[model samples]
Target: MARSTGAVGPSGCAATLTEPGAFGGSLGYAQKLSDDDPALPFTPGVDHGYLGVGLDVLGNCFGDWEHRGNGCETTSPAGTAFRIPAPGANMVTLRGPGDGTTGYCFLTATTSNFSTTGPWPSTLPGQLQGPTTSLPAGVTPAAVPSTYKFGFAASTGLFTDVHLIRNVSVHPAAALPQLNLVKQVSAASDVPLPLTPGQQVPYEYVVTNSGNTTLTDVNVTDDRVTGICCPGTTLTSGQTMTCTGTYTVTEADGLAGSVTNTALAHGTTPGGTMVDSPPSEVTLPVQRGPGLRLEKTVDEDRVYRAGDEVSYTYTVTNTGPTELTGIGVTDDRVDGITCQATTLAPGASTTCTGTYTVTQQDAERGNVINIAFARGQSGATTVESPPDTARVDVVTNRPALRIEKSVDDSRPYRVGERITYTYTVTNTGNTELSDVTVVDDRVTDVTCRATTLAPGASTTCTGTYTVTEADAVAGEITNVAVATADNGTVRSEPDQATVQVESKPCHGKDCHKPCHGKDCEPCADQRCEAY
Candidate 1:
């Protein structure tokens, strides 16, 4: 069977075959080998076993090319040198006619390396075999009678080890290429409640070859997106590939209330025919309903006073899947709000201006707070946004003053003695007090340190008074002080301080004598004080 080049040679060893009424012709053959046998490398005088398919052998199954030498190969093993299979192997193989070139005696599932294992049991009926050139189904159109060459690759061959032979045959099969497609949005986060306009929407397409043939010119297309691309054009049978593209969200998409897209995948067969997958589509609602955003702001932060003018700005935007009509802003405190347009498209924005005059009541309260909101109509539905509030602080004119009068010395005073007085003036109101001064009925020339008192500030003033003889006779004297500012618009309640006059003991004959005045009349134990 194997090293049996004696059986297969350039000699006339040919078989018979009826021309097929079918499409193309196929080749096949079968034989069993001992476990320890290795159909190995090509070398002269060494028998290597092999079979030929698709091509009619010029010489034999071993390497005997018509263009080159031919024989049972009395001189060489017939083919060039190549190691045979391992001891227990069953199949031996080589590329080309064993002369070493393109044709592989046994084509494997994927790679071009000719050496093959038990790919023998063909899935198709006839169990086709071939020299893997381009197609693995090896369908030859050329007519030829059945031929066989029993030979060896090197030292020993299938002759001695060749054990069993069964159903060995040949036939043809048609190429069937199929394609499948699936599409999906790339990022889950890119889509939210209301998809942002001008944002990128990424998509991925999966292309798969579902049939038993290779496919080329693979591509995908989307009705709503552009620039679809993929990494390669060819997809082997049962292989998959991914394609990608991006679509930008537009204002029109929002206005329509939803975005709908469809995609189709296409591929070309090796025969230059086109095949298409079923159309796929995805649709999503842009937003639930019409949306409005209102923002209100004052023109400036300057402190306001009574009758002060403040401008309010109302900015309105239409964020939605529909148009807004009869749009305007309203405020509880601001009046006569005017906008540029009565209708707005989705994603459109406009601003309106109005003025509010600060009244005396608002000034007294120190702030002007108002609530404002925007409203619009979408078809038959009336929509309004959440109210926005704006506040303006105003200055209140409430000026006040306070003063306290006190004697510089702490105790009893003598007649005709100089007494120094101190007056403190404080601004107790929120406003500044100008022309602030203190006045005392008994103390004269109250020189003030400052004529103006800022809010929450204090100023000191000084004055001097002399103890009169009458004051000494009265035993005690009191004086009042009041602060005045801003032409009496601000005044303080009067504050007073009193000092006692000390009584002198009568040292002369008056010690036992009664006195007329209270101060000089009498003291304890008949004593008298002189003024």
Candidate 2:
């Protein structure tokens, strides 16, 4: 039998056996031949043997061998033969069946054999004979041959053809570290459409380690804000961390119409190499100017009498992209209403109050209407609120009246004497009285200079009457008067005055004489000269 020899490469390398010869030379396998013949000569009376590979050294050959095929007429193994590289010392052993017994050969070489040159060691290191082995002081398993193969044959109870082989090389691991960062800005609260100054905005920085290596001492920072420190000092591959930052809006930000921020992340690799993530950025919009709105309301919508007090409330609001200052409120038809809040923030409101006394003119008009206005200043601009209006209805009250009548003359009145009667009308109710008239039952042509009387006001009307014979005969006269207002629909209670009428008494004796006929004679005496 013949086996081939070739270079021993690294672990995981493959070698093939076609026509057999001494296979792996690096594993110290040598062929023995009689007369240098190329082909194997089989004797019919002999039993052929199987060929196998082992990892061992000299007389200390150990472990089960990987059999390649049944021997004799050369059988081929499936796939390529391979060697598994371990953490420490490694060697090769060649085995074959010889005359009902097993024969072995061992070889040793340096762990790493990039180039094939070999005078294989005959004895295995004591370390290779044990269940576990450690490499020589200066050798590393990662740099060693990963695969090896050897072949040998036995015939007639004697071992013969042997060979060793190896395959390709493998390298050590590499170092790599990478980082990525992104930033975003958002409003902290319900902000007006346009951004406002003095508002708080939040910034977020997302840091990610996307490389195969772990990163240490990771830190994040923002251009617009400071003290943006990450939670963790280290980041692993495919892991992420978040950092926070904040900024207060400024006047310049508002004027520019927007605010911008940038963020960056940095970290160090295990190998002590520092790296930075790509810069990230975010932008927030600023609001334009201050806006104002006004609303007006009243405590009572309707008043039943003049001089009634009413309260008005005015609400002023700042509906703005920014804060408003020096806000003021005014009403076109009302007095004393104002704004309680001099400054207002976006989406904030405040109220103030005023009072008005219902006037007679207001009651006459039936309704009191008021309109309010609000104004504010934002930056250098002034803003006005939309007009708001409120209305109060006035109800009219009827006037009440009382009347008094009197006469200037005493109870006894002679015929043809003049008597004067007077009437007084007073308004006791809440409203004014107009078109007032006073009438006396005993006389005509009575008039008053004052025709209109206000609440709690009075008017005097006088008339004169001449006493008549009928009045004298009765010895008393009575007169009645009435006070009426507003076309006589309202009237005061009727009042009356009575006066007595009598003839003058006859003086001395003349007063006692009674003449029976017309034209009686004059008395001769002084007291009765007509007798």
Candidate 3:
């Protein structure tokens, strides 16, 4: 009954106790612990007394399971083996009955097999069974074992020790281990190339999954245009129905620039994000031009004689990518030239016609027989044929003419008598003058002249005269001129005048010759005398 201080009992690990037959049976206990640094649990003193002994429990009824000798025993009313002695003390002593007092003793056991019945689970010394072990991140521990022992002195029989094992303490926290995502590269497909400025070629792109987990809520975006109906818009997978999208290119200093885009795949991981594509390019060509040709011919060297028929022809051709519709040809070079049709196909040519009457009035020699041909759009500036002009000379075989006469009056003095006369001419022709000239020759108391004509641009010469008197005469007086330029006989056509003479008598005065007779003449006096 010396219960004055601290005491000891079995380790608090899972307990395995066996108290066989009531006559001082032995018990064993054991448990498991962690590998790093093993630890032993501390068992508490009895919560209450058992088997008529008001003492906390100690070790098994037997000594260490490795040996069967009398266990270094312990017996105290406190149910503890002994006082904890001091800071460095290890072993404790068990009490044996002093001869027939019917007292029991117990000693702790240590073996890999210590159990209540030699069949229960065991723990070697220095092992752990509770919260002393490390819990994984976000995790907790559970299901640890709890057990205790009982021993007593039988009042009417030999000393005996009995024990029962109970489950013991528990601890918990939280822990788990899975996959996550971090850095990644974007995915794209069918990126476009650049061409000219402000012109779009085509572009395409795709988004991919490159992370450790599934992703969700994916959306794509671009500043150049709308992403949904955009040109080159594409899912990472090539299985989408849309083949292409449209983007209008803009003006910039450089050939190209960058545009930011984003994507959101529907899921819980960073792998669900949309990715951008590489930039593309497009190219264009620039140019402009003209098309049509003209040519002309009008019976060569614009020369023709009277009654000659002139023909003009022009050729129009097309030399462009497009057809020359409504084409026309004009001949300002020549008059009376008419265009029949005015249309042409590429590389095609046609001819036009015109005629001129080279009449008798035409110039006989060199003339600028200018012939110009023009071709172009119907109402547009006409493209003239190169060297559109021609020159010509003409010769003619025709007739010619000359004038031949001069005249005044002089013969006799008379009151009302007439006299007539003539002059002649010649025919000048390589050919002859068919029907010669007929003269209208008469004198009203005056003289006159006449002639015959010639052929081949012919010429002639002649003279004229007149006479007068107071008496009447019947016979005519004639004067004639010869033809000088005509070949054989230079025929003379005569012109004539007639005169009448008479007398008047007076008495008591001498009668004198009168200036009014056939023979009467007035001399160079330029005057007439009276009878």
> How would you encode candidate 1's per-residue C-alpha lDDT over 1-531 as one tens digit per residue?
221111221111121221111110111221211110122222222112123322212112222121112111121122221223221122222222221211222222222223323222222222223333353456221222122234212221323343233453432243322777767676333343345466577777767787778888889999998999899989998787778888887778767777889998898888888988777676765644687778888843255668878899988877676899999999999889999877889878889889999999886544577889999999999978778877665655556787877775477998888888888888877566888878789987889999987767898999888887667657787888899999876789999998898654554446546654455443433455443
- Model 1 — which ten-residue stretch has the worst lDDT? 18-27
TM-score for all predictions? 0.36, 0.30, 0.21
**Models ranked on TM-score:** 1, 2, 3
Output the worst ten-in-a-row residue range by lDDT, candidate 2: 71-80
Model 2 C-alpha lDDT per residue in residues 227-291, reported as the tens digit of each score: 77578889999787777777888888877878888787999999999989878776767754666
Candidate 2 vs candidate 3: which has greater lDDT? 2
Which lDDT value does model 2 have at 175?
A: 33
What's the CA error at residue 24 for candidate 3, in Å?
Answer: 99
Higher-ranked by lDDT: 1 or 3: 1
The local distance difference test score of model 2 is: 0.56
Instruction: Give per-residue lDDT, candidate 2, residue 506.
Output: 24
* Leading candidate by lDDT: 1
